[model samples]
Target: MTATAEPRVLKHQALRAQLETLLDGMSVGDPFPAERELAERYNVSRETVRQALRAVLLEGRIERRGRTTVVAQSKVVQPLMIGSYTEAALADGRSASRILVGLTQHTADAELAAALRIAPGAPIAQLERVLTTDGYRVGLETTRLPADRYPGMLDNFDHTSSLYAAIMARGIDFERTEETIDTTLPDAREAALLTVDARTPMFLLNRISYDQNDIPIEHRRSLYRGDRMTFTTTLRAG
Candidate 1:
C-alpha cells in the first residue's frame, strides 16, 4: 500500500517563525545562516524564504549584506516636530529640500479620514514627495488635504516647494501641530523608492497640523532612514 504524503506548511510563515527563534538566540550583529542554505533545509522555495526574511528586516531586527542576513542594532529616537520640515532642518543647521513626486485628488481612506476630521470617502488632494537634508534623502513624506479647503491646490505650487509655506501664503496660517513617532521596516517598493536596501530600518512619523482657527489643515506621514536620523523631543511638566 502507498503511504500518504506529509502535509506541506506555508513556507513563508514557517520561515518567519524560524527566524524569530534564531534571533532570540542571537544578539544584534550576529550572523545568520545563508539564505539559500536555509531554504534548502526548510524544503521551501527561495522566494518564500525571501518574503519571510524581508519582514524581519523591516523591524530593524536584521540586516542583509551580500547573501547573508545578520541582526541589526536598535534605532535611535529623533525629536518630533509639528512645523515645516524646512524649519526643522534649518534649526538643526542642516539644509532642507523637497523633491516632488506627484499629486492627485482622491477620497480619504479610514486613517486619513480621522486625521483630517472628515467623513470617510471625502474628497482630498494627496501629495507625495521626498524630504531631503543637505542634498541627502532623509525621509519620504505624503500629505493629504481636504479638497474643499484647497480646490485647485494641485495646479498652483511645485510640491518640492513647501506646502505649508504656500498654503499659509493663501491665508491659512498653520497654528500648531501634533505628532507621533514609531519604527517600521519599508516594503520592497518603498525601499526601492527611498533608495535604501530592504535591510535598513526606518522611523515612521504621523503628524497633523492645524490652522489658527483650530481647524486641521494638513495630515502627513513620513518615513525616515533609521541609521541616519534621530528623533528627539524635550518634555515639559504640565
Candidate 2:
C-alpha cells in the first residue's frame, strides 16, 4: 500500500492556526516571537513559518514596526451610510482626528464643473485632510464645494472640525449621496502622507452629496487603509 503525502498548503494552514491561537493570548503592541524562534518551537522550517505569518499580517492581526512584528489593534468598523469619519470612529469606540493638509480656492475645471453642476471657471474651495484614528494615520480625504455658495469658507471654516457639521451649521443638510467604492494602491505622495508602503492596498471612495432641493452640495474623494478599515452596510429584503 502506498501512503499519501500531506499537501504543503495544508501544512502551512495548520501552522497558521497554531500561530493564531498563540496570538489570542498576546496583547496589542506585544512583540511577536522571532521567526527563528517560532520555527524551532513549531519544529518546522523557517520558510513554513514565513508562509504561515503572511495571512495573519494581511488580516491586520500583526504589523511590522521598525524591525519587529507585533500584535496589532483591531480594524475600525465603518458603516456604509451617510456619516462622517469622526462619527464612524466614535461608534467603534475610537477617537478620530484630522491633519489639515491644504485649504484653498480655485476655478473649477470642466470635470469639477460637471460634477458640481456648475459652469466652468466657477469658484470652488478645496479642503484636503489626513484622517487619523487613535493617533494612527488611516485615511486621506479631499472635499470640494462651490465657493460662491459658501462664501468665506476658506477664511471662516475651521478645517480641523467636521465638514458635515460645518455645512449643517450653514442651514444646508445633506439629503442623500451617491458613492462608489473601489480598490487601489497608494501613490508615492499618498504613501508618505498616510505613513504606509507604496504597495499597500487602499479603499477608494468617491461621493457626491445632494441637498433637499436635489442640488449637488459637495464632492469628495477619500482613500482608506484596507488593513485598518472595514466597511459595513445593512441589507433589506423587498
Candidate 3:
C-alpha cells in the first residue's frame, strides 16, 4: 500500500476511537468537535473528517440534529437478532425496572387488531407499565397479547418484571420479533407516565413479536425518553 493509504486507515481508526470515547461519556444532544477542529485534531483533511463521522452515523452513534452532529446517549444498538428486552437492557448495564400502571382484558381496537393481526372484537390482555432507569422514569410500554395464547396471562406475572421473560417460562416461544421506531409527541397520559411535560419529543416504538410458528404473540407500543435514549440500527452500504 502507498503512504497515502496507510494514513487513511490510521485516520479512520483514530476517528472510531474518538467516537467510542464520546459515546462512553456524553448524552444525546452533546455537540461534537467542529469539522474543522476534527481535521486539525486528527491531522487529516476535512473530507476525512466527514467520512469518519459518517461511520459513526451509520452505527447510530451520532445524528444530525441541528447545525452539528450530536452524540446520542445510550445508542440502542439493536441487533437484527431476536432477543428479549430485559436481556438487552441488562446486557447494556441499563437499569431495567417496571411499575404496573394498568392491567385489563378488553376487546381489540382497530389499530390493535391491525398490528396484532386479530379481529377487532378479539379478546386481548392489555398490560401497561412504566419503565425506569436509575429510579428516573425513562419510558412507558403498553402491550396487547391475544387472550387465546395465555388463558390467564393478566393474572400470571407481576407487572414489575419483564412480560417476555415470564411468558417464556410458560413454555411459549416469545423468541422472535420485529420492530419499527419513529419519533412523535407525547399525549397527556404518556407524558404523565414518562414524567415529561406534554408534547415533549419521544421515541415512539412499535413492535410486533412472533412465535416459532410465525404467530403474532405480542404487539406493543413504547415511548422512550428522547433526550436520554437513542435507537440504533446497523446498515450496509448499498
Cα lDDT, model 1, residue 154: 73
In candidate 2, stretches whose alpha carbon ends up further than 4 angstroms from where it belongs are 1-12, 36-51
Best by TM-score: 2
Clashes of each: 6, 0, 1
Runs of candidate 3 with Cα error greater than 4 angstroms are 1-81, 236-238
lDDT of 1 by residue, 1-238 (tens): 9879987877697889888887898986788877788788888888998888877765557765556667765533345655677887777776778888778889998988988889999998889998777665668899889988887777868766778877887899877888877889989977866777876778888889988898899888899987557767789999
Clashing pairs in 1: 77-231, 78-230, 78-231, 78-232, 79-231, 79-232
CA lDDT of each candidate? 0.79, 0.89, 0.74
lDDT of 1: 0.79
Better of 1 and 3 by lDDT: 1
Residue-wise lDDT of candidate 3 within 10-119, one digit each (tens)? 67767777767867787767887788998887688888777777666656566555466677554443334455555677777876778899998899899888878898
Top-down lDDT ranking: 2, 1, 3
Report each candidate's C-alpha RMSD, comma-separated, in the order given: 9.9, 3.8, 8.5
Best by lDDT: 2
Clashing pairs in 3: 28-73
**The CA-based lDDT of model 2 is what?**
0.89
